[model samples]
Target: MQRSRDGRCKCLSKVGLSWKGSVDEDVVELVQPLTGREQFFTASSCAGCIILLDGGINGFEVQKQNRCWLLVTHKLYVKDDVIVALKKANGGAVLKFEPLVLHVQRQQLQDAQILHSVAIDSAFRNSGIIVGKRGKTVLAVQSTHGLEVPLSHKGKLMVTEEYTDFLLKISKSKNGGKQEEN
Candidate 1:
C-alpha cells in the first residue's frame, strides 16, 4: 500500500495532473531534493502566487465556488501588471497573495510528523499532517503569510492607480518564494 501511494504521486506528477498541467516553476527547487528520496514524494506544491479574483459579496474571503480568476501568476509581478488587471474586475475584485504550500507523502507517520513539526517551527504556522485511511501519511507545509486587498466594488475601481501600484509592490515583496534554509 505504501509503495503504491508513492507510485501514485510520482505518476500524477509525471502525467502533469498535480498542477493541472506541468509542474510549477515556482516550486521546482523546493521539491526537487525530495525526488530522489525513496521515502518522500511531493503530492503538490506552489511556492507563491498573486491572483486577481473576481469575487462576490463575501468580500476578501473569496469562496472557491463563486470566484473567478481574472489574473493569476506564480511569479512576482510589477505594479503596472496589477493596474492593468484591475481594470477587468466585475465585482468584489480581490488581489491576493499566497505563500509557499506543499503536500508531501511519506513512508511512515513519524516521518510526516517530523516534517510537519519542522515546518511549523520554521514559521509555517498552518503546517499539519494528514493520516489517510489506507495508512498513508502526508505532511502539509503551509504558511500564514497571505494578503488580500479589495481593488474594486460593483465593477468600478475603488482606489487610485497609484495606491494600487504600491499594493502590488507590497505583494511582490511579501511573496517569500525563495528557497528556504531547510
Candidate 2:
C-alpha cells in the first residue's frame, strides 16, 4: 500500500475540540462531551465574553481600550453555556458581554443538519450552514443574547449585571419556540 503524503490524521483532525487561543473553563467543560462523538468537531468558539478598548468608536484615544473574547469555543455546544460562561467575567476593563457563539464542522450535510436541530433545541437561533474552504460543511450557531454598551462613559463600564441578566432572560424566552405578545 502506498502511504499518503498528508501527515495529519484524518480521524483526529476532524473529530476533536480545538481553539484559537485561550478559552474559558466553563466552555471547555461544556464542549468536552461533544468532541468525543464521531460526527462533529469544533473549529473555533467563544462562550460570549467582554472586552474594553482605549479608543472609543467615537474616536477618543485613552490607555488600553481594546476588545477581547472573554471566552471562545469552536464546536457544537449548548447556548446556555455561553451565558453561564459569563460568570467568569469579572474585574477588568470589562465593558460588555458577547453571547455564546460557536463554529462547528460536521462530517457532511446530514451532520450539519443534525447539529442544527441540536442547536435549535439548545435555544440557539440564527443557525446557518456553509461549505468550508476544506470542503467541509460548517454550521454557524448563535444565541441572540448579547450586549454592547458604551464604555466611553467616564472611562468606566456602563453595563450592569441587571442588564445582562435581562438579556439572558429575553434570549432564553426566544429559543426556537413560538413567541407570545405581551
Candidate 3:
C-alpha cells in the first residue's frame, strides 16, 4: 500500500487501486495475498520516476497509445496477485499494500513541479523508499544513532555548523560511556 502526499492511504482493489482518507483506508477488497515475490513498488509516469518497494519495482514507461505510462519490472518470484510492504529509505518505516497498480497521466509526466527522491538510511540500507510529490519538502527523521541535525532548505540550503559540533559531542559522549542527546 502507498500513502499519498496528502496522507491518503491507497491500496489495490478489484476494480483497481483505491484511495481513502488517511486512517480509514482499507484493502480488503482490493488485494489478494499470495506468495513468491515479497516486495512492492509504486510511482507515477515520468522519465526518472521509480519506486522500489519490497523486492520489486513499480513505475511508468512510455507506450504506443500513452505518452507516459507506469510499468513494473517483473521479477521471477512475482505473482499476479499479492500484498507487500512499501519501505522508504532514510530511517522511515514500511507501508503495506495488498496489490500494486500503476497510474499514468500526461500532465504528471510533463510537470516540472514534481519532486522525486530516494532516501536510504544507513541503518536500513537494505530497505529503501522512493517519494514523489508536487511541492512537498521531505523531512529527515530523528536519528537514533546520531545527533538530530536540522537541515534548512532556504538561504544557502545548508546545515548549521553547530549541528556538526553537536554530532561530534554526541559521538564523544557515546565513546566515553555516557548517554545523552547529541
Candidate 4:
C-alpha cells in the first residue's frame, strides 16, 4: 500500500507486483489490470514510466520521450520468453522498493514539523497517542480516568517522583485487563 500527498490529504495508490525475469518493459505491462491495456510515459532515458491496463496478455502501448525525440507505438502479443527473461533480471526489486514508497510518504508527513505524533505501542492496545503543535503527548484513557506523558523534551529533560507515581498508576490500570485474562 502506498499513500501520496494529495493537497492537504493523503491518498492511497496501487502498483502491480511483477514476477521474476521481467524487464522494465514487461513490468510496465502490469500496471492496471482491469482495462487489458498497457501504456508508457517516458520523460527521460533514466526515468521512464509505464502503465498496465486490465489483465494478462503482453501487448503494450508505449510512449517514449527521450532527449532527442519522442516515440509512441502499440504492440500486441509480447513473447513469454522475453517476459520470463526480464523477470529473472528484475528479480524482487519492485517488491523491495514498493513498501519504502509508503514509508517515505508517511515519514514526510510526520517530519513536516507542524504537528507532533503519538504512536501507541503494540503492547498497549487500549492506549493511543495525542498530539498537538505545542507539544505531543501519549495518554491512556481508561474507564475511570487516565494520565499522559510528553516523551519529548527540548533543551533539558527531567523526571519527577510525582510523574513516576502517575505513570505507575496508569501502567497498573492498563495491565489490569491482562491480569483478568490470565
Candidate lDDT values, in order: 0.73, 0.52, 0.24, 0.23
Sort order, TM-score high to low: 1, 2, 4, 3
Q: Which candidate is the best by TM-score?
A: 1
Model 3 TM-score (2 dp): 0.16
Number of the candidate with higher TM-score, 1 or 3: 1
Query: Lowest-lDDT window of 10 residues in candidate 3?
Result: 43-52
Best by lDDT: 1
Candidate 1, position 92, lDDT: 81
TM-score of each candidate?
0.82, 0.53, 0.16, 0.16
lDDT of 1 by residue, 61-91 (tens): 6664678788778766655777777787788
How many pairs of residues collide in model 2? 12
Model 3, stretches more than 4 Å misplaced? 1-145, 154-159, 177-182
List runs of model 2 lying over 4 Å from the truth.
1-23, 56-94, 153-182
After superposition on all C-alphas, the RMSD of every candidate to the true structure, in Å, is 4.8, 8.9, 19.8, 24.6
Count of backbone clashes for each model?
0, 12, 15, 16
Quote the positional error of residue 151 for candidate 2 in Å.
2.6
Tens-place lDDT per residue, model 3, 20-75, is 21111232222222101122222221111121222111232212232111222222
For candidate 2, lDDT tens digit of each residue in 15-109?
Answer: 23434443344466666565556566566666664433223343333333354344433222323554454444443323344567677766779
lDDT of 4 by residue, 27-107 (tens): 233222311211111111101221111111123221222211111111221223223322332111110001000011122
